[model samples]
Target: MYEYIKNPALIHEGPPRSATSMLSKPRVPLILVHDGGGTSFSYHLLDRINRPLYGIENAKLHDGGWWDGGVPEMAAHYVSLLGKILPEGGDILLGGWSMGGLLSLEMAHQIALAAREAKSRETGESSESSGTSTPKTPIFRVLGMIFIDSIFPLRLAELVGPLPEEPIILSGEHSRTMKLKDKVDLNMTHARMMVRFWQVPRWRWRDEAVPVPPTILMRAKEFVNRNPADDQSFVDYTRDLRLLGWDDYDEEHGHFIRDLWEVNGHHFSIFDHKYLDDVTKKVRKAADKLDPPEF
Candidate 1:
């Protein structure tokens, strides 16, 4: 088992790299971003899964403010922070739920751009002369992505309601007694950013826009509405995503999504004990594709 760190200030304990053993170098880090709540600690259930896993919570959680940054800004910020944590020339895997999933995709796209730029620079420096030569930059490689029941062009306003005085989650230990006002502020701020990101015509990683990396989407069987007015039919939602060019299934050996697993629960409840085992196993299997087990 990976040693869990307890920190009141941090959304997640320790860094991406945790000790697996003294002799073996830690595996590539699997970084999971936070949902709209801005706390990655919600993924505490994933702690039982073996791998170098780290959660990227919003900076607002650490610093006192709401995250008003758009998708591009948020991705860049995460990339900058990640540069310090991820090992140079090491593999990286990104995953997230809801808004976090969308953010993760953008992050992967940015990382790909950075990797390409790094390679091009190195190639240019090394070559005496030539534009035809391909330079390899192994400094950073994205293994893949994992998106948990995420939807693009997010309509989260209807869903984000007044926060309860008491914490909703009983499983994981939380730091502070959150106020209703703070919760409302965070939700509104995040929703605004989500809308802004949606309005952008296209995603330009560099000279070329790129699709998200090969992803494994863990979809909930149903979309349960906590509030009746915030209702969207799961079937219709899936169709909309497909129309937006979201392919949740693998085809041949190309395009973003590689696999789709439907878990037995509503969007929020999918990560609970009833469905977490299946979700965790699938994730572990995906990790194995990048680094095969020695045993």
Candidate 2:
């Protein structure tokens, strides 16, 4: 967990320095997960959002640990951490960019599961044959979700078609060279491998158990273009749907996306200085619709 303090007044000196002083306030915090690069450094640039902001980076980046599971397992691990981070659990807005977005969705799902289990335990206490009651865990409520240019992995093949026979390496031999000593590079390699082989489960949104929160998709205005000669960009190909490939999936599942807003740049450049303001503005608009924090 990394804290990005936009307002210096939020911090206070104490016997032991506390990194979570902002979280102690009545305001609902916004937690952004790391992208495929396994780092949340980019989120630090979003200093304009008028809320307490925190970033959840990959543990591997700090403790030199490795993740051996897929999205569900990873989300469960983060959810457990949140239990301790905010002992007096409260509502929070969750979101992420790219791979982080997918992970956030899974995290929200796991949180809902925990809430359901806790509710069941409370209701079933009277029927227990042995009169032993298990304590319920405090679950953090997700007020909403903001997906920043996150693509649906399961629909990638269907939307983009088959990969070309020849590998498309931008920098030729230079791209093949791996920086073994660099932790970011190593983490990126592992994350990409996991993404490539990941089998996204065919899970449906169960409104009874896991009610979908207010969700918004912040899509990039420009499409990703790899080949200069290619005339058709992703935007052109996906013009009919206008969702960048999420339309069909959103409809098939639960139609949870309440709105879709286009930011100023392409996927990679959305965070750049030239376009970050527009992204921040859109995020603020979405955040305004969320329910107020409950202290």
Candidate 3:
């Protein structure tokens, strides 16, 4: 059973923020994003791993107030919620499956920015206190990002225009079971936001002025080339990943590394018990390679 952690920050204004599960004493907290259905149910099997883990539920599960924002906005909400749960200015390890992976990437990027701002503020405060300049260093670090069978959706705006007014079908069993109209509205909002999310440019270190952390991409072997569109999409996505420096790995020098692991079964089916052992093994191996927390 998943132990849900409530966010005290939202005790009165909105529904409490929820975590799918949490570890008592994690080496470093690993937070996973919710899949397309906007629930962390799909990642329930990952609880078997003996690591500090938390799965973020979709904001829509609470209210429809944040339904219209793009990836940046969603990531910002998570960054705030995570700050409340994680140690202040501590290292974070993040991963996601499918669209959740893309969201995780954006969240990591946003977290780094927030960390820099906080560092700058602290440095200025220290300099004022002692009347001496203090060199600023990063307070929080995103160790790495794990991508599971995720392809960045970069053409959503062009594909889905003006935020669909019609209700989208909630295909997942978890979503289909929801009775609240607002919850269904949340799903529609996410679908529309996803169409807008692709508008956010890929993280290019030089162009975007954002740090690209090391990434581990686990692919579903059977799903990559299911159709011509899938084949082309994979090619295009991987091409950008390489261009954005997701193909480099050098553990000895502590450089950002991007590695890929091919797992059995299709995208959705890969999380089943039959394949979870192999999946968890690869996830742990990738996470272990990330920079260890400072003592």
Candidate 4:
């Protein structure tokens, strides 16, 4: 369902590269999912990472439709697309910023599930018991995951309480201003709605059957202090930055390597030009851990 867009500049000494061609390279491709804005354009600002990089955006954005599903459904859609893109299957690095980060976790889980199912079918365990043919899905080995300033959904709720109720009626001037704001930034409006409506189902790494890949969590050094009077004070938020609410899972499982890097700037500003270089550097460093050491 996701169409591969061409980026001639990203092509290195080869024909104009498509998605499949990008994955066909010797190095495992790093796929970054779009943030809440439903577009991966922001990722283009990143400096060259010395690896094949692909950004996956919401197909609905191009088709003028809306994603009416939750995080799981969205992850499933991407996993299916990845299967088609690399039918032969190979290792890949998955990551994203904010909402994309949450989606990446789910995507990794789904990929592992598919691989397990595929293996079961191979030894006649699944088919013999179920009496139904298991549809073959491409198996992918996830090298690691990079989470950019992403807070777990449960933690997010504890930090910021319930969403404020929308006023039934607004003043004429205020209504006009709201409409203008939406027009000026339609993507933001859509993103806000998508996030507000969708529910994040409970997911835990320990509950999963497959082993989780090594994870690198790049947390913002500063917390956004927009609402000073809010119940959750800045101190409480900053104190939790050590793990970014992933402490429980990590403490329990200890199956994969977990590294946390604090990057300079607040959550949103981390993507700004002033701080983006540091972010890019950290990302590249985190990704490099999965690579074979140069002798």
User: Pick by TM-score: which candidate is best?
Assistant: 2
lDDT of 4 at 90: 84
Which regions of candidate 2 deviate over 4 angstroms?
Answer: 1-26, 62-66, 129-135, 155-182, 197-209, 226-241, 292-295
Give lDDT per model, in order: 0.59, 0.65, 0.60, 0.65
lDDT per residue (tens digit) for residues 1-295 in model 4? 3344542123122123453355434556678887766667668788767666777776544332244564667788888777555777889888988777877888887787777767756778645676666455678988899988777555444444444343122344543455432422443344444455555433343455456778888888875665768565322364354776677666555635378888888777778999878988887788777643232
The residue pairs that clash in candidate 1, if any, are 89-139
Q: Can you write out model 2's per-residue Cα lDDT over 1-295, one digit (the tens) per residue?
A: 2232331122112112243354344456677788866677777777456566667777554322246675667777777667555677888888888878887888887776677777776677756666775565667889888888887665443444343332222232332353424556555555555555566543433445246667888887776675768665433455336665677767755787888888888777889998777877877777656644233
- Weakest 10 consecutive residues of candidate 3 by summed lDDT: 8-17
Task: Choose 3 or 4, whichever is better by TM-score.
Answer: 4
| Model 3 stretches astray by more than 4 angstroms | 1-26, 62-66, 130-139, 156-163, 166-189, 195-198, 201-210, 224-257, 291-295
Q: How many clashing pairs per prediction, in order?
A: 1, 0, 0, 0
By lDDT, the better pick of 1 and 3 is 3
**Deviation in angstroms for 100 in model 4?**
1.1
Decide which is better by lDDT, 1 or 2: 2
Model 2 CA lDDT for position 223: 61
Q: At residue 247, what lDDT does model 4 achieve?
A: 75
Residue 65 error, candidate 4, Å: 7.5
Off by over 4 Å in 1: 1-26, 62-68, 87-89, 127-139, 154-185, 199-212, 225-230, 233-236, 239-245, 248-254
Give the candidate order by descending TM-score.
Answer: 2, 4, 1, 3
